[model samples]
Target chain A: MLKVNDINVYYGNIHAIKGVSFEVNEGEIVTLIGANGAGKSTILKTISGLLRSTTGSIEFLGHNISNTPPHKIVSQSLAHVPEGRRIFLQMTVQENLEMGAFTQDGSKLRQDLDDVYKQFPRLNERQRQIAGTLSGGEQQMLAIGRALMSHPKLLMLDEPSMGLAPILVEQIFDIIKALRDNGTTILLVEQNAQMALSIADRAYVLETGKIILSGTGQDLIQSDEIRKAYLGG
Target chain B: MVFLSYLISGISLGSVYAMIALGYTMVYGIAKMLNFAHGDVIMVGGYVSLIAMTSWGLPVWAAVVVAMVACTVLGVVIEGLAYRPLRSAPSLAVLITAIGVSYFLQNSAQLIFSPNPKSYPVIINGSLSLFGGKLTISYISLVTFLVCVIIMIALTLFTSRSKMGKAMRAVSEDKGAAQLMGINVNRTISMTFAIGSALAAVAGVFLCSSYTTLMPTTGSMPGIKAFTAAVFGGIGSIPGAFLGGLLLGIIEAMAKAYISTNISNAIVFAVLIVVLLVRPAGLLGKYVPEKV
Candidate 1:
């Protein structure tokens, strides 16, 4: 559903992502696991068109969206839940969700909001509460819920599990699995390689802005290098 | 009696400033750009209304409607041409561009409209007495005050209840995330400029009607005052700007009555310095954490 090909991202002459490439087929959960400063988030940002790549291209469902404006990317069925829970702090939980479905038409918007509400009933309970006041776990759910409002075919989450408790992390992984089961392709970037590998169909390990390892999740988990380097086994 | 008269007039003037200040708050809240040309937009709006009513021979209502439409279009154009390209530029660059736009608009007005002030033909001629001999408010003042209050109510409802307003708030909070949610950041920013410029138009007309004079440079003082109001109220908070406007207006009037007109601005700024020293975020603004 999405392909990022040999993209080079520069932040004022610093090559953040050096020729990184990856793909996610429809309905698959593909994760990029790396340590801090490994450029996992930059790759996700480039795919979403938030950052322009000096070289290489991004294709979404067979269309070149590499240079497309960030706003237009969502219309093409790609939504990005950024690194932090960057929820509109002043807005209510319901308002955040409404903002997510900003591109949808009347009936589809209503249905989408309902679907998101169903996925996270806790959001429905706190519909009128300000998002900033919500707990870290709740804000994470709202962030994911807001992205789901776009009804995207592929959702790119940058470290959704970051700062979340281990128990909450497990539940979040379950939600990721459920989302994939329901036909939504996902590109998840995570520091928790073990948890991500458990749910991912395929996985890639990044180092210094380059993809260093690739395998099926279970296979990578069983690999000696992956176990030692990422899984902390 | 004289004191009460000045107070009433000050309230009327303050109301108009509050109306225009909302525009500043709205655009600044979302874009974090001051829209320095906003004041000049108000001046152009006055001329637009003047030409419509005088040269085009339209009725007062028709002229107001035309002026508002024209200014809204002008605002959208300015945002497109001046702001859209520099959306991601550094905050300093945006501020400089805004001042550039401000000067550009003021000079353009000078070229098209005469430099000398022109009087707005009387639309309301009567005055009503209140508080026995203490107060007498002009029909124009009453009308301007009522209109400002109405616009404030409408704006409050729009931000709180309307979907587009919520989209605006969302964009102001996080443009990148807002784009990811399918909210058109550019469009929303354009709309904020449009709405803000439109309200400034209304203020222009009221200001001209109240003072009976319009000039190319008319926007400067009010623009500064409105900017002060925005800062006083807390830059991004709507109600804060409104209260700031009213407070500044009242203080200025009281100073003119008891002290002198020369020191009114100085007093206001001094107040601002003191207020900001105590609450750096202004009255309604809260300190937000920076992104890591």
Candidate 2:
């Protein structure tokens, strides 16, 4: 489980995430749905240590890892798949996966690599292909596969569905569900409310850098405001 | 026979420039900072070697070892003290700092070593006749050529195969993402500067030996030439820098033989300009895809 308590993040003078707090339990897909500029990505970045919170605590598996450096955070069993599929474009797909496994050593890397390839067989087929040439869907799969290479306890995905075709988006959502079913805890930040609610166990609605709603995914999906604003009623 | 000798001589000199260029290219690839002080770092290496060999009465090898270690430490410290604080600042700020470091080093050397050109003790002063031409390749020149090639080979292997190298490449591609992956971005950047400075130090020592004279500003000409080589090869491409160095050296030699030495630098710059006009990115540097 991960607990983020009243975190404030600033970019220069602008307060990006204003005292936002959230919790994610074990083996659950928790989606943070928000509009553009709502600081959803900022929250995820702060938790992952790419951007530190001005004042707040992020406890991962009961360890106060708030001040830990970004790279060390991954070794602590938290993997952050960034907003853009920031794959090493020049690198082959296999090399990108190897990079994800940077924090681990010994035989554990081989096992984790095998597991990731098994989860995404498409990656196995094109393992030697340059990552930049991969389609949007394949790149997303590669990013997620890279994160899984770390054997991460909690996988934080920022907009995995971004820029994909409808079919690929559906496939991505399905993979997210399958990952949770296979016992990987996930924190998904998405603007696509309907698909997110359909798969997420718990969901929080964010508006203007604040969490406005939280409930079981099904309950939120059926809510009047959610149906009107996000679900296209 | 003279042409062959010239070509051999060109390649040897080219190799040295290429080695130093690798340092510039590597540091630029990761941090995107030009580190104008990089040249000064090499100059400092020459002085360090001078002091160790002449003042401290150390052996040639011992002098080199001490100079290299000192350069590495200085490189890392500059990265920490000067470049580190300006990380998030504009590239202009970093560029200014680099110039500041260069000036600081030059003046400090003037104060420490004085403005006189001191002869570096001849590590290898003898010459040999080869290929029917009366060629006198200095002992230090051969060593410089061999060392450059060896370092280039080792660097290629390290960047491709080692974990730290992979971390460096990752940072080059995307620093923010690399950090999220749990890489110590700042430390990696520092390591890059250290490696670059150390290589520059070796180049400085050999260069001084070839010229048999050390001045406070000896790094300028070679530094500019090496930077040109890096740009010619492709600013971020390793092998590109090597090819560019060799090409520049050969061209300079040909220009000196057939044309005027005064216009040699002008001709080289003109060639670089033409290359840029044709392909904005250097020969090996590919166009980075615009982030969506």
Find the candidate with the highest TM-score and give its number. Answer: 2
lDDT of each candidate versus the true structure: 0.87, 0.87
Cα lDDT tens digits, model 1, B184-291, are 888898999889989988888887787788888898888988898889888888888788887778878788778888888888788888988998888887778775
Write model 1 residue lDDT over A87-186, tens digit each, in one string.
Answer: 8888999889888888877578777877888889999899999998998889999999988887789988889998989999998989989998988998
What is the alpha-carbon interface RMSD for each candidate? 1.0, 1.0
At residue A67, candidate 1 shows an lDDT of 90
Compared with the true structure, what per-residue lDDT tens digits does model 2 show for residues B1-292? 6786677777777887888788899899888989788777888999999999999999888888888999999999999999999998999999998999888988999999898998886777577756554766656667877887788788888888888998899898888878776678999999999899889888878777766788889887888889998998899788888888878887777777678788988988888899988988998888786875
Task: Give the fraction of true interface contacts kept by model 2.
Answer: 0.72
- Badly placed stretches (over 4 Å) of model 2 are B132-138
Instruction: Label model 2 with its docking quality class.
Output: medium
RMSD, one per candidate, in order: 1.9, 1.6
State every prediction's TM-score relative to the real structure: 0.95, 0.96
Displacement of residue B124 (Cα, Å) in model 2 is 1.8
Q: What's the lDDT of the predicted structure labeled candidate 1?
A: 0.87
